[model samples]
Target: MVIINPTISTQPAALTRPAGPAPVLPADRVLNAVVLGERAQHLYELSSGSLRMMAESQTPLREGEQLQLRVLGKDAQQRPQLEILQRGTQDISPQLRNRLPEQLSLNQLSASLNQIRQGENPTLRQLIAPLLSSLPRRQQLSDSAGLQKALHNSGQSLEAKLASGEAPKGDIKAALLKLLATVQAQSPPPPKAGLARSYGPSNTPSPSVHAAGSAPADIATPGTASTAKSASAPQPQAASTAPAYQAPPKPLGLPGELQPQGRLPPSPPEIEGTLLSRLAHDVKGALARQDANQLLGLHSREHGGSYMIELPVRDRDGIDVWQFQFQPPRTERDHSHNERGSQHDTTQTGWTLSLSFDLPGLGAITARVTQQEKQLGIRFDAVQSDALELLRQHTPELHQRLAEKGIDVAGIDCRRRSAQALTESSYSLSALLRDQA
Candidate 1:
């Protein structure tokens, strides 16, 4: 009886459960906005209801384009992150609408110039000749010798600037913008009946074809070739009576399972070796000058390309090594032609960075960070059991490291993966290691 009384306690031990982290409530709302300006890395400064916020986009948005954006929470800096749900039906300013086309043309011209400087397009004359010829007529620069001189001088100046390792000055850009705005104010010419054809159909045979046909006669009668040719040549004849042969149109699809069922492969990368070399040189120059904006431009060109950035740091093991590799967001090009005979391409932009190192007693670990517009993601891959346990025990250290590098790690996730994950694009490990050495 005494043993029973001792076994039965007076009060039961209180069962306590550990408290969980606080829940995050999503903030989603719709807002009317207009793009006011564009900055490096495709970030746009937008105006909405007494608020000015920065927004990132995969495609370039023209200034004054009305937008209906879904506000999807704020970033670490408290800037409202936006997701464009729809294009606004509200009318834009008449001046902006009128100048939009001219603005777009000018932007394309500027991009072409940059591509030429980067050596992406080796035949600069072929690309710039049309723009140069049309500029005088379209912008009314034919009579303004000073403006024409400025345009000509700007080309040489740009070359010199590139050679001297100087950032692109905005003077030429400002002049071009002003000229385009003025041109937009003027009335456009009335539509002609049709675009003039570069080559027209003709009944007359080409001189080369005629010579080919008369070659046998000349070879056979070298002594009397002139007289024979004169006698054999036709005199002012009507068009040939025979009709030209035409090939039948090909079928739209294959006979059976061979038919194409999905989207085509993306267009090839636009940035070749020459362009990459030029960009690398420019990036080094910018880095030497500590010009962050200029460095951003080299990586964030209109066309997608791969780049590598390394920062030296001491790891948890107290070993000095490169801590990070930055690959700026890039859009893959999917080119298509519209009914109007104009070419267009689609692009997708997302920023990615990776970190790799080995702990003193543990094995190798790699961390990948990706950000697409407003969303951010983190993944830990190729982790050993011991290292995984160690990382779980000291997870805060990873966050601190990222924060020190100016990366926001508030909403990031940490996980252990048995196998490494494949990226949309390769990480260029060889190139990165070579550069580090």
Candidate 2:
């Protein structure tokens, strides 16, 4: 006899495989692709993973920058002819949308790092200590070389360091990512059970049940004593043996463990949290914030706008987060830095460095330093009278230090910061610098 089995079917396989047809891109449908630089002059290579085509872009496009495109139509060669909607990082619209919801304030991250020296996790402490040590000391800001070093290690050039195929060993962002991964690995796996179950409900029942069926053949008859006494009577064969069922002694949260029918220990109103876990959360938030800042910087670059970096300086007292803003010359936007070179470095152009931070004895202070030729103009604003006086007293020493580095300071100006100072800094940095002067 022939038998046909219905246990297997090719229908399931057919359902899983997608229909053998190409995806349709309707005309004028918005698409996103990365610009792969110039093919020839104004012509650019644009790709959206599955497709690549060349299109002429009126606006200059940089390689590896994402572009928002709209499908206009196909060319005579059947290649996609597209219009550039938004260029360069989608103008970072996507980043702001995704990152802002998850980001925590940088101040919280600094506080967490401050507690690291006292952390019990030696592995975590070791991971971050090296990065912190790489940061420039406050004293290093007195000269140009040290300032450049600070800029390199500020975590702002982290992407550049990676793109250049160099190890970002001493970079703060790299270390934070490492720490985040380590801490995340320690998170307990989620419980897999669907619901509460009795003692090892997932385990197999014992084979002892088979023992009940393995009796002598004559045992069925009570009056078979005569037959049992016969010398030729067949002996009973042994049944397969297996260990009896045993309930595992694991906690309720663990897999295949029994959920006891008793009251559990009540959770407390508040409990002290672990340092490593807390630090992990803080690091995650800080990284998100960094991602947001980098996005903002990408959008600002086209306009020759300023970029801000928060440098956390750890000291004997505590960690202090200093904000530094660097603004390139306005003309620098039009011409590439390499192309401009010595021509742009002339005394006619100037660069601005603005700093804001708080000190142990001194109150909140802000400084704006402008460089023109070999000469520098320093303007400091302080909220406290004592802080202003102290800065004024140290102006001559600051001037002397800069002069030693061939940085001549025409004058050092100290002023009292007003209530409108924060307001001014938020709106126009130029105005803030002007008001300080």
Candidate 3:
């Protein structure tokens, strides 16, 4: 064996290799994308899918795998026109199905996919992916081939027929030449307001839907002829008379008789108590004066299916109380708010409130609804232990539901952020309000 230099060691200083392809993305990482169109384009990220950077030759942009979109120009309406530079793998979603042209055959689409997969010259894999997924689910290549062939043949025949026409007759040629000369001799005319309808008879009446009017051989019913004659009359004034109103009555409503609406009968007076009104009053009083010290004792429940009492505490200085008004059905307060069953009126508070509620099947979770200008924004708070566990274990299912509504919640670390802030739970609000007053 050869003697190695003691200073150099056996490894030869381990030659460093350049970095390889990027690691595959986790399902929760949001992948940014740009949708380009003549009208409007969107730059967004898909939060719940895998993304991969393909080889440069396979997908063109100089960046190789990483795709960056450049917005070129805005149309008259200020919509963006975009162009993509790199290629990345994107997830197929039902929403992306609209990118394909109407009536594209599945076979043609498959061929297009093959072209993209092969990374051929001038191939656009990124552009092609959206179109492939968007084709109508019901389309079949075998069925469409016959129709496509017929159309191709018809186009060829039409071109041949146009080419095979005989030379124009002497008189016809002379007349056509004269007409052309006259047209050329005249100055271009100003555009008219409307064009005349040229396809059908000028006075053509709307077709009678009945079978009798469809064919000349069919015997006309007693009043059908008269009705047709009256409809075709030239005098508008006569057509507007009582005699013109003698058209046949329409068939009785639809095939099925109108089903009576099933509105819930009114609840008993005792069941519809003043609890909601009382709760609203307390919330309104605390929010209007911005009094943090205000507190209210409300009946609530816990996640273990036990009914308990909850005390809502607002900490601030105030003897001030305000009357609260409840708008009708549309504006009725939603009391099933939190695990403690406490409701918060952020709209009146100009702040955000998180309340947890224990419900069957869902266990417990807090819904944080914020008041922003004139609208109320709602989102789930991560306080519910059971719900967070479900989310962590079932990421894909959660993502699918959230994606349906275009929500990209990929970066949320639920386990790390699902703790509730500790606060004093004294439900004795009425006595406190009295003391402050």
Best candidate, TM-score: 2
- Pitting candidate 1 against candidate 2, the one with the higher lDDT is 2
Global lDDT for candidate 3?
Answer: 0.27
User: Which segments of model 1 are wrong by more than 4 Å?
Assistant: 1-303, 311-318, 332-347, 393-437
Pairs clashing within candidate 1:
none
Rank candidates by TM-score, best first: 2, 1, 3
lDDT of 3 by residue, 61-136 (tens): 2111234444344334333333444445322111111111011111222322343434443324443333333222
Question: What are the per-residue Cα lDDT tens digits for candidate 2 across 1-437?
Answer: 00001111111211122223333567777878887655654455667777765544434455667877776666443444556667653444444444543454454556656566555657656766765676567777666797777767767778777545468866777777776887667643222332112111223322211222221332211111233343474533223122112222211111001111111122222111244445565676668767655655665575567667766665665666666766776443332366547333323558887887767677667788888777788998887899899989998898888788787788999999752352122223222223323
Superposition error at 426 for model 2 (Å): 6.9
Assess the local accuracy of residue 367 in candidate 1 as a C-alpha lDDT between 0 and 100: 71
Estimate the Cα RMSD of every predicted model relative to the unseen true structure: 30.2, 25.6, 33.3
TM-score of 2: 0.56
TM values, all candidates: 0.23, 0.56, 0.16
Candidate 2 residue spans exceeding 4 A from truth: 1-89, 119-127, 140-143, 189-273, 331-349, 423-437
Query: Residue 72's C-alpha lDDT in candidate 2?
Result: 66
Clash number for candidate 1? 0
Of the candidates shown, which would achieve the greatest lDDT relative to the real structure?
Answer: 2
